[model samples]
Target: MKFISWNVNGLRAVVKKDFAEIFQKLDADFFCIQETKMQEGQLKLDLPGYRQYFNYAERKGYSGTAIFAKDEPLTVSYGIQAPEFDHEGRAITLEYPNFYLVTSYVPNSGAKLKRLDFRMGWDKAFHAYLNQLDSHKPVILCGDLNVAHHEIDLKNPQSNHHNAGFTDEERQSFTKLLDQGFMDTFRHFYPDKEDIYSWWSYRFHSRDRNAGWRIDYFVTSKRLADHISDSKILTDIFGSDHCPVELLTNTL
Candidate 1:
């Protein structure tokens, strides 16, 4: 089946920027988006043949996540059950017969690492949550994880070394997740590929120069790695600062 994930940045804004066309063309079995930035009834999507699930942040026009899937899930949950983090509407988990699909908008460390402490707490909690899910069945997780796991994942690692997404703590948290048996699908396919990114800064003509970071991802349980058919970054499509990442897999 084909699963696509994009950090649309803002759903309402993207709807006017060829989102409908892209949506129709992709025709994915499962389409997930992060940073939706809207609550229910604010907007409606005419996605034919897809059941939609949305988790809206308590705060207005802030962090949120949603999923539109051609097949109905056996169960749908809004968050990982952490009340503290749930208020932000940053997560959604859909349980299918074979696996659990989770889309998340991981908290950013913020400027000057202002929120690094909170981000770390979230990483720890989220790590345990994923492990719990993996204990039951393989998990397919995707979204703007908000961190560039390695120097290769971003364009200017040296300068961004102390930046929010590239901070040592943030990268290590991602490493901890991977060590816990989650496979980053894109890296699995293109281990040495460079200059390919999913999120770009609006400033500095970043997109024009391809000065972007691959902070978004499609990750699955290590056991499902063999079923991964393709993992790609569709960096050309633009509506938001972030582009779409795709995963074609046999497991789900």
Candidate 2:
């Protein structure tokens, strides 16, 4: 099976670009996107042969997520089994016969780490939620997790050390998740591969210079690691600040 994840940044905006063309080009079995920033029925999407599922934030045009899959899931869930965090529409889980596919747009720690505390809480809750799913079956989690977990995951690690996405707290939380039995699929396949990133800053010609962070990911239960066949960062694709990240697996 093949899965693709992208943070469209804003679905309303990207659809005006090349979203339709790119979506057709990838043609993934499961296409998950984060930061959709649109409410239900807010945008009309005509994706032939794909079942589209959306979770809208209570606040209009804010944080949201959606998943487009060729197969309709046995069950679909909107949140990570939490009510407070459900307001943002940050997570959507689809239960297939073999696994649970979760797409999440983790809350970004704002400037000066203004939302750091809330982000930490989210990490804790989400970790437990994933573990609960893993107990039943392997889980595939994807989206812009909003953290550069390692120095190698970002370009300006030294300078970004204190930044929201690269802060010690966020990085450590990511580590905790991994230590708890999830594998970062990209790094699992290409640990030493450098300069390939998913999300780039529009400022400072970051994308031009390939200065970006590998915050978007496709992670799974450790036992599913052996089934992973290929993982890629599609830097050539464009529509949002983030390019699509992909995963191919035999066990899916």
Candidate 3:
């Protein structure tokens, strides 16, 4: 099935940016979105064949996530365990017959490392949550993880070493996740590929110049790696500072 993830930047904004056209063309069986930046009744998407699920932050026009799936999930959950985490509406989990699909908008560490501690706490809790889900069944985690996994995942590693999303601590957290039995699908397919990215800075014409970071991802339990078909970055698509990333898999 085709599983696609994109940080629309803002759901309302993308609708005006021909989101419907891009959505139709993708025709993903499972469409996951991050950073929706809207709340209930703020906007409506009339996608006919998909079951819609949304988690909105208590604060309006902030972080949020939504999932549009072709097949109705057996169960749907919001957040992992913390009410604090749930309040931000950063995660949505949908359980299918075979696996659990988690769409997340991972909290950013902020420009000056102000939230670095919070970010690290989140990484620990989120990783634990993934393990809990994995104990039940394989998990497919997607959306903007908000961190560059390694030097290869970002355009300028040396310059960004101390930046919020590219810091050593953040990168190591991602490494821990992979070491815990998860595989980043895109890297699995193209380990040597460079200069490919998902999210770009809105400043300095980053997107136009293709100076970006691959913070978004399609990661799955190591056991599901065999079923991964294709992982791609849709860099040509326009709307948000971030572009869509896709994963084709047999496990669904």
lDDT of 1 by residue, 1-252 (tens): 899999999999999889999999888999999999998899988988999999999999999999999998899999888888889999999998889999999999888889999999899889999999999999999999999998999999998999999998899889989999998899998999999999999999999999999999999999998889999999778899999999998745
Please provide TM-scores, in order, for all candidate models, with all chains considered together: 0.98, 0.98, 0.98
**Candidate 3 Cα deviation (angstroms), residue 235:** 0.7
Q: What is the lDDT of residue 144 in candidate 1?
A: 95
* TM-score of decoy 1: 0.98
Over 4 Å off, model 1:
none
- lDDT score, residue 186, model 1? 92
Q: How many steric overlaps are in each model, in order?
A: 0, 0, 0
Q: What are the root-mean-square deviations of the candidates from the true structure over C-alphas?
A: 0.8, 0.8, 0.9
**Candidate 1 local distance difference test against the native:** 0.93
* Model 2, position 156: C-alpha lDDT score: 91
Error of 2 at 157 (Å): 0.7
Q: What is the lDDT of residue 200 in candidate 2?
A: 95
**lDDT digits (tens) for residues 1-252 of candidate 3:** 999999999999999988999999999999999999999998989999998999999999999999999998889999878765778999999998889999999999997999999889888999999999999999999999999988888888899999989888999999999999999999999999999999898999998888889999999999998888989999989899999999998755
